[model samples]
Target: MLAELINPYYLQVASFILINIILGVSIYITLSTGQLSLANAGFMGIGAYTSALLTLNFDLPIIGGILAGTLLAGVFGILIGIPTLRLQGVYLAIVTLGFGEVIRVIFVNWESMTKGAVGLSGIPHMGRELLNTLKEFGFDPKILGLQNNQFVFLAIFLILLGVTISIITFFRRQNRSRVGRAFAAIKLDEKAAESMGINITYYKVLAFAQGALVAGFAGALFAHVLAYISPADFAYHRAVEILIFAVFGGSEVIWGPVFGALFLTVMPEVLRFISEYRYMIYGLIIIIMMAVRPQGLIDVNILNWLKLKTSKRRQKHGTSSQKSM
Candidate 1:
């Protein structure tokens, strides 16, 4: 384990965790509004394939490709949301799942561009220009003593970390707004929320669109990090994994899904020694956790515990200050 920590592969896994966290958070966005969207993987595939093709064919900047992909995904997300968001529960999930399969089939059949399951290769490095720009500013990235890929992963991880923090902060603030209340009300009972004049469909679509934006951005990052992508990489199984992260992480908490992603991404690697048994073990652990804490690993009880601890510390500090005065 210590050796692995020192190796570059560890950094690669860390980057993977960051990417998964972003995907999990994307699902959480829609989950917050009581919508179950399984088409996140489709949006991700759209972003990856679109960005890769743009950069590969048009010689566009990698960042531009990523931005364009995200925009296109958001547009498509709204379109899909409009028609599908009307369905609720398992029916909605099935429709989104079908959409994901449709995307996979398209990628598999489009041999000329998508390479027909051969996947795209020789993807340009996203940080090539950025590294050159840094050199122009008299900064030597090589001085960091890391391989180019390692350095790129670390840089991407930091950038994504900032993005994650910003998203969490935004949602935390949103939770206090009227829109947040509407989401909560709708989640509790759509009929009651509609009685109060809240536009349920609008909020649902908005949440779904927001989720697509994040998932698309994450997909772009995944493509650049890997420099290779395949249709199967973003298939139904991958979508299910992202959903598991959201459910297991306590979607009600902004950071819960992030931690869930981190843990799940790392757990398999940690259990590498067990090989085949590891999966069974992992399944057992998840089953036990679900039975013990169905609310999730980081549910409201943990949040309330932390809040109480904070209040106690604040009270103690205030008492000390009063005594000193």
Candidate 2:
């Protein structure tokens, strides 16, 4: 049972979970500012294609591709944000949804570059590429019993997940800062926020661009993990999936989306026994969640309650220790 759990397929699934976590956090950034942008998947496609092309055609290192892809996506985000941030509610969503379709169309038509719907395959795997580079630098993995490609991939995924979480922690901290307050104010009441001397446009655009950058980073990792990507991978449905990750988890806090992504990503695998009705059950679960807890599985109230419990436990433990002393 232990060996089965450690199999390559399971390792790959774990890598995918990490990728979805990044995606969830990315959408959470935009949702934090009350912007319902559906263009994240488009930005993701941009990152995936850019990285794949750079690595496959220009022979760029995986790290270099990742950075380039991330930055380019940010640039596109800024461009898109500036013009579209003026629109509110469904107007903004419709525009962004159109933007995603436009990106998909470009991917499909730009056959010379994107290979159209067929996708660009044979993109170098990050783990394999890193191992080869290490070998070149005289660091042999075979000596460490890391010869299996899956093990190497797992190691890389863990490192990336840690780094991603650390970065998210920083963002969470920033949420408590002035910028975060501004986001909250805007979310609560945009007119009031502006009346309070907040530059609504700047903050809105900033949030959108940040979300794009994060989504792009996730996409770069995703491309290498799958070693292939197509236009269909970043279509409207993909955008909805990313949104669900944030909405299902609760966008009030960063960890909400993380938990959402973790649960949703793994839930299907755990329910594979009922393969015929898996999707039906999945949809039912979501509908139930939406009806029961529209705010999400986690919210401010839950966090506060948990904090209170922890503090009470600590106080009790302190009193017991003092009495024993």
Candidate 3:
């Protein structure tokens, strides 16, 4: 694993985790709002296909392609959510699952561009080739960027990482805001939240849309990071994996998903001996983790924080009682 530390493959792995972080965070938005969403994978597929088609067919700039991919996915997400978010529980999952299937079929049969199930190739590498090409064009790789692939990859990785961190920090703050409380109440009881004047449809669709949008962002990032893509990559299993990470990380905690993404992305590489059975083992481990720490790794790690909060509250209560005495 240490040998891979400086490899471009490591950048590939880091990119995977980064994309998953976005995907996981998107799921967090929905689950935190008390809705189980499944269309995230579909959005990811949309982003991948969108960016690939744009850059490959039209020769669009990499950045432009990524943006277009994200926007297109967000649009599709909003459209799909409008009708499906109204359904509750398993119904929503079924709806999103169906959407994912539809996307897979579209990418498979659309051979004119997507190469029909063969997946897209010759994709522009937004991370590696882009950096190298920039350097070759006489740009000062140092004043402009790094000549080393590792350093360049790290620079781009930092940019993606920063965006993710900023978004998480934003949401963490929002968790204490009025909208966050409303979403929480809605999650606790949709009917009761509506009774209390919350707009159920608005929040529900917003949750799904937000999740889809971020998944799309991750999808675009994934496309550029790998410089190649295939329909198999975004299959139902991919959706399930994202869900597993969200749950395994404690969907409610912002940092939990990040750890989940990182661990899962690197776990198979670490367990190289069981490469063939890695996925199966991943499933087994997820099952065990869920059974053992259902709230997620973050919850387990922050036991001290919870204890501190409880102790402070108890002390405050005791002081109030003493004053009464």
Report every candidate's CA lDDT. Answer: 0.84, 0.88, 0.80
lDDT per residue (tens digit) for residues 235-275 in model 1: 99989999989878878876778878988999999999999
Residue-level lDDT tens digits of model 2 in 68-158: 9999999999999999999998899999999989999999999999999999999998877777777799887566655557457767677
Over 4 Å off, model 1:
1-7, 127-129, 136-138, 142-150, 310-325
The lDDT of model 1 is: 0.84
lDDT of 3 by residue, 204-311 (tens): 777777778788888988887777788888889988989878778786667777778878888888778887988798778888998998788786458568866877
Task: Give TM per candidate.
Answer: 0.90, 0.93, 0.85
Clash count, one per candidate:
0, 0, 1
Scored by TM-score, the top model is 2
lDDT of 3: 0.80
- lDDT of the structure predicted as candidate 2: 0.88
Ranking of all predicted structures according to TM-score, beginning with the best and ending with the worst: 2, 1, 3
